[model samples]
Target: MSTTLANQQRSKIISLLSPAYLWLTVAIFLPLSAMLYFSFLSDVPFGQTEWHLTTENYQAFFQTTTYAKLLWKSIKLGLIVTGFAVLVGFPCAYVLAKVIQGRAREALFLLVILPFWSNSLVRIFSWAIVLRGNGVLEIGLNAILPFEVDVNLMFSTPAIVIGLVHSYLPYVILTSYLALQAIDDNLIDAARSMGAGKHTILWRIILPLSLPGLLAGAVLIFVPVVGSFMEPRILGGRVGTYFGTVIEDQFVAVFNWPLGAALSFILLAVVLVILALSSPILRRAQT
Candidate 1:
């Protein structure tokens, strides 16, 4: 009877999970497997007489300083964007979670996530128009100011950062809002009743509990920003030559599929390492 019940349970579990796992195998695993195999090859095996394995694609990264420097630049850019996003998002989240109430809260929350409703490419292109030398921003500033001013912020690092932050801000706000809302108002009230100041309450009671959400948001922003190509290309122009753009060039311009795959795999490894390092802190934040 026990053996029969175990077999039935196992079958039920498989029945429930089979479709999702099969979908993952088809969608994600198979592509990654193909990419991995390509990363070790000398060239793409399409219409080829012979194909051979080579580690030169990976070695080129180490032998050359160019990719490494660009990768570091991307990392730094990610950090800057993430930092700004955190600073801007946390305060907005706090106001929404604690200060606002009723219909106002709902409207504002809608506004916060409204960015997601629009296409990011459209948004970035819009930013390009707004930041041009004699563009909307410059015209607006000139209208307000007595003196003439140039507002050519387009095709620069700050423009790239601005575009990225605009896109990623919603992620941080959503995460921080959820975390902040989950905390009990009673705990804050009790702290205040004990003569704890606003700063003290925030430092001791709020930040600790909401840390996981904040970190998760930061990770979300950082990972994608590090691998971003589109915004940088559109906004940064020549100054936007980072690791991601180079990876893109390998496949599109250079016609080196193996090198592109290797670069992509290396980036994946880096992202995994970052998550692994942060796992401990995230675990602690929950408790």
Candidate 2:
């Protein structure tokens, strides 16, 4: 009777989760599978999709130097933005986790997350307003420094990076704070008692312990930054096209669904490869 009851409980738990599993399989996996299948086929003339299996789409993607360059640029930009987010976010999170207390900490945490409540498009548009010709930022800069020349900030690579960093910085701060909070207080006290200074303790104890969160935040920033179309579309202007724009053009403007699907799968494959490469680093941090 005891064995039967245990088995029955297990079955009940599985039954409860079965609906969620089914939904994910249908909603997520099915579309991904369809994309994968379509990516293997060729595009017909006038934007028709043919089901015949061919590697031409993949070949075309690689053969084009511009596409390859854009992909590399996207990866580089994502990495740089992720690095900046971590650098800025780590100290802020450390302060929140270690220094603040009670209501004040709660208030600060709210402030950190409050920006996320607004629509991302609204925020990007605000940046556009500030950075455009003779806009708020330029006017303010000129007012402050009489000799300063008005700098064009909109439709530039730097503007896109700034926008991406703003969009994702909150995630880095939240993750780093969680990681820092998990560190034992005694470890820091032990280091201090051993005559270590604040800098030494931070470097030796806190930073190492907080690395997993840092890595998690980096991954979070990287994944989105690489695939981001909106920020680059609005801010990138004519400086250069990223892979996201290329994929978007194929799908929306050109109406080449098969080619677009192939490009998307290729992008997905690149992301998976990055994640796979980073798995060892993540595992090491955890251990």
Candidate 3:
């Protein structure tokens, strides 16, 4: 009777999970499988798929120096932005989690999230206005340093970095704050009672404990920044191309869907490799 009951419970569990399994298969797995399958086909002359399997797309990606350079640039940009975000966000998160209280803390949290409510494109355009020649930033700079020529800031690599950091800053702040808040106050107090200096406590106790949040924020910011198209497209202008823009052009402009799909997979592979390399650090941070 117990064996029969166990079987029934197992069957019920399977039944309960069946809908979610089906959804994953249909929504995620199927599309990914289709993309993989289609990526091997050659684009037919005159805008048709020949449907013959070929490795040319993958080969071409490697053979092209520009693509490699762009990939490197994307990686560099993502890392730099992640560093800046962490540097700016960590202290703010610490303050929010440890110092502030009541409505003020809630209000600050709300303000951090408020930017996300607006359209990203609108925000980018606002930056464009401020950075353009004779715009607000230029005017302010000119007033401060009249001898120095006012320089245009829009459509530069720095502009793209600033835009990406702005877009993703809230994620880092929230994650870090949650991690900081989760720590036991008694542990910190104990360290203080032991005569640990402020810097020593921060470095030895707080930073080590909060590292998981730092890694989570890094991963969250890094992946999107590398794959971002809009910021680089709108802000980068003709200065340079990122990998995302290349993949986008392959599909939309060049009409090479297979190549685009292949490039997308390559980007995915790169991100996986990065995560794999960082896994040890992430695990240690969590512990």
Candidate 2 per-residue lDDT over residues 1-287, each given as its tens digit? 99999999999999999999999999999998987777787664344533577888888887879878888898998999999999999999999999989999999999888769989999899899988889999898899996987778899988998888989999999999999999999989988999999899977889889988888898999998887888999987996489888889888898777788888888888988999998987787667
The RMSD of every model to the true structure, in order and in angstroms, is: 2.0, 2.3, 2.7
TM-score of each: 0.93, 0.91, 0.89
lDDT (Cα, tens digit) per residue for candidate 1, span 145-260: 99999889999999999999999999999999999999999999999999999899999999998988888899999999999998999999889998899999998998889999
Residues forming the 10-long window of minimal summed lDDT in candidate 2: 42-51
- What is the descending lDDT order? 1, 3, 2
Tens-place lDDT digits, model 3, residues 133-246: 788888888889848677687889888988888999998998999999999999999999999999998999889898888778888999989988888998888964899999
TM-score of 1: 0.93
The numbered model that scores best in lDDT is: 1
Tally clashing residue pairs in candidate 1.
0
Every candidate's lDDT: 0.92, 0.88, 0.88
**Alpha carbon lDDT of residue 222, candidate 3?**
97
- Candidate 2, which segments miss by more than 4 Å at Cα? 44-51, 144-149
lDDT of 2 at 286: 67
Number of backbone collisions per candidate: 0, 0, 0
